[model samples]
Target: MGIIRTTVFTGLLTTSTAAAYLAARNPVISPLAATDPIWTSSVFKRHNPSRNPATQDVCIRRIPLDKIRPELLQREGDLALEFCRGVWSGWGFAVQRKYLDLKYRGPETAKQLWTNEELAQSTYDRGTCIADHFEVVEKTPTAITVRCGDSPRKQDPRPSDGLFVISATVDKQREEVELRLKTCLFSSEGTIQGIKGPMPAWMEEMHQWYARIWSETGSWRLLK
Candidate 1:
């Protein structure tokens, strides 16, 4: 309850503090339920810069679960349904609000995870290095469970503790992949480092670049 409490509202609950708080409160509620939120936000540092190097924006996304997927069945597709009901609905709005101050292609990275298999596999690999072991626990018609390989070490209190369940739903009717990613936002104290700051002029230039991309592309469209 408290876990879901923080992600939905932007207060003092940072990623660095969330994991431990959730772990302490874990026995009562399922991690999947904890992921649900109407609103979610995050701040991330952009990696490489075309122009302005130092950019930080808090992005937010708000979406209704019903409008999100037309084909998600309620009874059979529980994991996928729960995740969409919880996270994905919020993720789009988070992106819209610029909560995750990402480097280049942050939104692209998220889109790729859902639509690209090779990229998803690479993500799985990266999680392995961060944790001791990772495994896909269950695979449903449209959902799967991924358990972390290693538990957060008691002494290593950086804010990572819990399992994740992701789902892949194929709209057989539409021939589209409806991939859903659901995970606990832990307090990793994890910060993206080594970004070379650009001049103020460069920031303006990069903004134009992103604006142009958003204006032109269907996925990154900027509404007038």
Candidate 2:
């Protein structure tokens, strides 16, 4: 009887430990902030007055700061910038090398940004291909916003002449910090209407996949 009781107790302890470990690995996410202005104001509205914009929100992860030193927040900010810039490449997406120059992070001067040029090669995905221009319309220590639109050089407007905005923000509250990514899609192009149902679904899938990739590999790169 003693031997059997000891074996049962050991198995129970092992199961409890495994459950606790799983809970720690997946943290809960809390609300961080309202919709940003770039999404609300800048996207496709400039080109098509009647355009209705759609937003997709992805709560990447909530990081616990209790064990980490306070001074590391600056490092976190830099990591956030790197994550934003490298996300597309890190995900192994098909991207044209020429347009990669538009992924700048810091403050931008008039000439240094892609305010009036096409974003990247036409070989990019359909939604991305419509992004003719990109500019760093907003930048701060904790947040960065990139605006995308149609080429200013074009005389006639194409239905694809819409706007897409990507914003990354770091919000710290008490013992935890939240990193969130928000994207807005505004398109006037007639072709987009046909793919509207699948566009958002695809974007959400890509966003979640990138988040997992960042959590597994990119976050560790920051620590190194």
Candidate 3:
């Protein structure tokens, strides 16, 4: 009943706009019960660096599952991990993990939030606040993917590490609930570069406008 904590995870890269409206009026976004990803040995290996591909920066969102929010469906009963833990407790994702604990995608991933050690990467575990230098790889109950720990900081055209993908599925003939936001880039001579961050095109259009409002209002605002 108190598993899901708050703070941004996907399609997020900062903590500015007033900490995303105070993480959108904080209710801890209920709807827990969709948690997994505390493995190690670093996995998810897929690189294709010919130039630009990872869907050329992407974002998609949908939510309907009876318009959500009955104390976020009470708890873990897996509705695609309760819509991916209600889009990792939606709304501006704790100013996008406080903008990666102020790393801002630089100092080889600055503060390393939740640096694991069996969930010392806390936000009370499970629910997730992202950023232990991005590593999840892939989780189930719908989908989750996180990657990055490869670069030593090459600097070739800018970008270094890659992949920040999220997925949650449950269409059930359109009852609704589908979320995907991908920002794949890797070109410190590594490869697989999407949206090749040569840096400064308004910071790649403000990180594709914060990954399209962190995927259209952070997982469709869990029943707005």
Candidate 4:
């Protein structure tokens, strides 16, 4: 078949031109941040012996949190959550979520357009992913660890993804906040394309494409 569509984060797989398409028009923020996005993965040989190295996906976007539009959040909302939400709220991922919501029988009740408070509550309260399609594994002022298996689709997938952590760390020295999106896939019985081991290079490239979108979306929201 064609490229195997995968990852709640890999929405760009179907639409490869999304970045180029969106790039034509100017967004609110430019240059993203002082640093470029970083993508890395490891199997955690000691801790996660059964984990697949191909399963872990980490996307990092470093931007100045101080430069955010104050009007976007005034109440007791976490900026970091908003940053991560923006990554999910990006066009490609949003479309995939909505499509799944329409196709699935048990569509989640979470709002597609989230408010700052809603995100904060979802994370800090450790609410079920259905409340919002995110499961809070851990939370701090600067970082929040979320799992992909929050909803039915993810909980039951072709090959499931694992823990996703988003961090918006403030640094006085660097004068920018680092927004990192990390996901380590948990082992399951399923495998894509009869390959029980690592995925194809195209799949890896697709992962990198979407990872960059995480920062692009975050940057757009930072200015919007």
Against the true structure, what is each candidate's TM-score?
Answer: 0.24, 0.45, 0.29, 0.58
Question: Tens digit of lDDT per residue, candidate 3, span 1-224?
Answer: 12222333332335456445433432122111124121121431333334432223555566677876655444533443444444444554555555555654455545334332322212222323245445555565555656553432322233455656566666679876666665555443445434434445566556665565555445543553
C-alpha RMSD for every candidate: 17.6, 13.0, 16.9, 9.7
TM-score leader: 4
Q: Write the per-residue lDDT of candidate 2 for residues 1-224, one digit (tens) a residue.
A: 32453355346436756334323432322221345454345433455455443333333445565533344455635535543443333322213223544543224423332321232211122223222354444445554454444443342444434332332334454555444454444554443433242245666565444334333222222222
Better of 2 and 4 by TM-score: 4
Q: After superposition, how far is residue 64 of candidate 3 from its true place, in Å?
A: 18
The alpha-carbon deviation from the true structure for residue 121 of candidate 3, after best TM-score superposition, in angstroms, is 31
What pairs collide in candidate 3? 8-93, 8-94, 14-99, 31-72, 33-76, 34-81, 49-192, 114-121
The predicted structure with the larger TM-score, 2 or 3, is: 2
* Cα-based RMSD of candidate 1: 17.6
lDDT of 2: 0.39
Candidate 2, run of 10 with poorest lDDT: 115-124
Point out where model 4 deviates above 4 Å: 1-54, 70-77, 105-124, 130-134, 149-159, 188-198
In model 1, how large is the Cα lDDT of residue 185? 28
Per-residue CA lDDT of model 1 for 140-203, tens digit only, reads 5554444432332232323333234445454556554344344432333344345432225465
Residue 102 of candidate 4: its Cα lDDT?
A: 65
Local accuracy of candidate 4 as per-residue lDDT tens digits, 100-143: 55654243454432443443334443433533455555566665
